[model samples]
Target: MVMGFREFCDYEWFSFTMENYVVHILFSKSEPGPLLEGKSKYVELGGVYSAQLHQAHTSVGQTHIHVYARNNQLFAMNHDGSAHDRSHGSQIPNKVAQAITQKFPNFTLPKDNYIESAPSGIVNAFGHQLLLG
Candidate 1:
């Protein structure tokens, strides 16, 4: 079922923040209906393992529309930076921290050179970096 922008945001906010789920937002500058060829596109993409369809909306006075999907894969990456072949060692790197903050304005990393220490198996998901210690 398709949902509106407000509903989508509400669901996303609740799921990501309150429920600790990952949400992937796909935005389009055009109507998503035609582009998606109706709901069947979801199945064609990757079945249930793929990102779940959340909503598609066009701006009130504009032609742009956006599609939102959710999944948990974003946090599945190994925190050792092994996925990228670089060991961050206890603290998040300055450059990496900066990029995270830039992508998510609401997020703030410690101003100090490094964070105290993160817990094991921390993952960066849903545009938010999870530093569990």
Candidate 2:
């Protein structure tokens, strides 16, 4: 069984293959299909547990697509939807505040939305301040 992204409206069938004993391919579609177009490619998101995925995200500037985990605590990759990572600025957008706030209820922000303790240009990356222990 396969599901498609309604946004693309492309007709394509998903295929699942087991390369080795360690990988399981699920919820996949071909090119021009839903969620596979527009500067999208397979990437490995790094964090507590690594997961390979196809995510659409910006490489620079203000626009980006993040392939975050269901919990939104880990980062998969940022492509800027381009062939190269330099096509756009390499920084997480401020809009991520909304996503983080939804995930971590303990998250709190002062008057400013940006990371206050971070350096001038540096931010928390995922939004909100990281309290030091």
Candidate 3:
């Protein structure tokens, strides 16, 4: 199955390819989507484990996407190693928080999680469903 997002939607979307293309979409519940226009970037989100992700999150201005699980809940957050890491919903807009929080099972801030940032700005985040300790 495939999904889509709006071009101007507040939520960010990402794509990765293996046998088929899968898009990681961040969305809100209030806004219905026919489909979201996702990113054309190549990323390798691990399926085996989540511990492999760790990065330099010290600079807020530095662009990066972080994905991790805590209390059995999946989360994706932007920028890291900054003072703002503690404040949930500090950076995200009201509409964005509501959309993603309701749309996806993943939500909340992350730290020292699997981080990714290509040549382009890092926005959307992906996490492996199976947790491995």
RMSD of each: 15.8, 14.6, 17.6
Q: What would the per-residue lDDT of candidate 3 be over residues 18-106, giving only the tens digit for each residue?
A: 46666575544344553422332322233321211223232223333333232221333533422223333234334433443453333
Q: What's the true lDDT of residue 54 in model 2?
A: 40
Give the winner by TM-score. 1
For 28-62, candidate 1 gives per-residue lDDT tens digits of 53443234524523211222222122232334321
lDDT score of residue 11 within candidate 2: 40
Clashing pairs in 2: 57-65, 57-80, 58-64, 58-80, 59-80, 60-88, 60-89, 61-89
Q: Write down the worst ten-residue block by lDDT for model 2.
A: 76-85
User: How well does model 2 score by local distance difference test?
Assistant: 0.34
**Candidate 2 colliding pairs, count:** 8
TM-scores for candidates 1 onward, in order: 0.21, 0.20, 0.20
